[model samples]
Target: MSANHLEQLREAVVKMNVDEAEAIAKEAMSDGIAAMIMLKEAMIPAMEAVGELFGEGEYFLPEMLGAVDAYNKCFALLEPDLKQGEFEPKGTVMLGTVESDIHDIGKKILAALLQGNGFEVIDLGTNVPSETFVKKAEEHSPQVIGLSALLSTTMSEMKKVVELFEESGIRDRFRIIVGGAPVTQQFADSIGADGYGDEAQTGVELVSRFVAAP
Candidate 1:
């Protein structure tokens, strides 16, 4: 593909132009561009740039959310084609914001990052109960189960999920990963979480490593 076409796709993503982005993605695929190449060369870089801007405070939550939404639109067009091929996920992850915490922005970003890296994420949404976590794990048999808690008080809820897993005798079944603003490595260790991340990117990486490990 020409540099211009690639640049157009990147610009569409950065500008949050969902329709244009999807069009560019479909056009790229029709031109015989590889889906993984489009994802790595175009979409992931765009989202990474947005994430950098977010870290720099140049882009706020609204901008980040808009960019993610646009990227999802582009992915929606490419995903069907990719799924038709022999696509193996990097890993399977089950994610949720723990009970009593209604915050979702962090969890949503984590989901996007995981998807960008080729993990199949099953998001359980906000205010998820401990039993739900165990039940979903039983159903999906994911490699990693991620719990998010933004509130200091709700941090303990991560422990509740862990306890529930132990009670179900499936604690050894999957690695439990935890993250959020109030979460720390120490806290994760204390709560019997297998991993902890300080940011969305790190959280995705952490799960990737845990799942990839033999």
Candidate 2:
């Protein structure tokens, strides 16, 4: 029964059937299955498969966008169950588009991917200031903070976020990850970011790795 439900869940996500996916998530919750088990066994793997298809050009932006929306809908349905059930979060993550940058498509995808993979995500919406990021980090104490900047002019704010962490003497408290257009491995290194993801899936993979390690 559980296996069948999981199978259906994966198909729903792959097909970008938001209603179907949300129904299945609610159904699993009613059946007393833990939220994390449903996610790890079905939803997360489904998104990974979607990512693979996208990477191979078998899926395009519109399809990927639909799939991501479906995934988020399913997660929204399961969120209450996740909080009320015995599921353990992989790790907490803080995410946002840095100050002076308003773009969010990639960052939003990364947030969904992280949440689907069992990470607790604190999403600070686009154009977040460095001071806000640091304060939130101190408040949430997450394992990682992801910064996004879609423009070269705005990219410097990512470094300022890191500097605020340093000034607060909490630089070691969390891992800093940077991404979005105009961001690169070298730019990440230059900004003193702990990691860089050229794309959303890579960002998800990096966060997964960081959370899985002791």
Best by TM-score: 1
lDDT for each residue of candidate 1 in 1-214, tens digit (9 for 90 to 100): 5566678888888888888988888888888887656766787779778878888999998897888888878876766554443357878999999999987756766776677677888999999999999999999999999999989999999999999999889999899999988899999999899999988779977887898792
lDDT string, candidate 2, 1-214, tens digits: 9888999999899889989998998888789877767866887788778878987999998998898888878777766555552247889999999998877756766776676667888999999999999999989999989999978999989889999999999998889999986899999998798899987779888888877772
Off by over 4 Å in 1: 84-127, 139-157, 167-169, 178-190, 195-214
lDDT of 2: 0.84
lDDT of 1: 0.84
Model 2 misplacement above 4 A? 1-86
Compute the lDDT of residue 167 as modeled in candidate 2.
Answer: 92
What TM-score number comes out for model 2? 0.62
Model 1 worst lDDT window (10 residues): 78-87
Per-model tally of clashing residue pairs: 0, 0
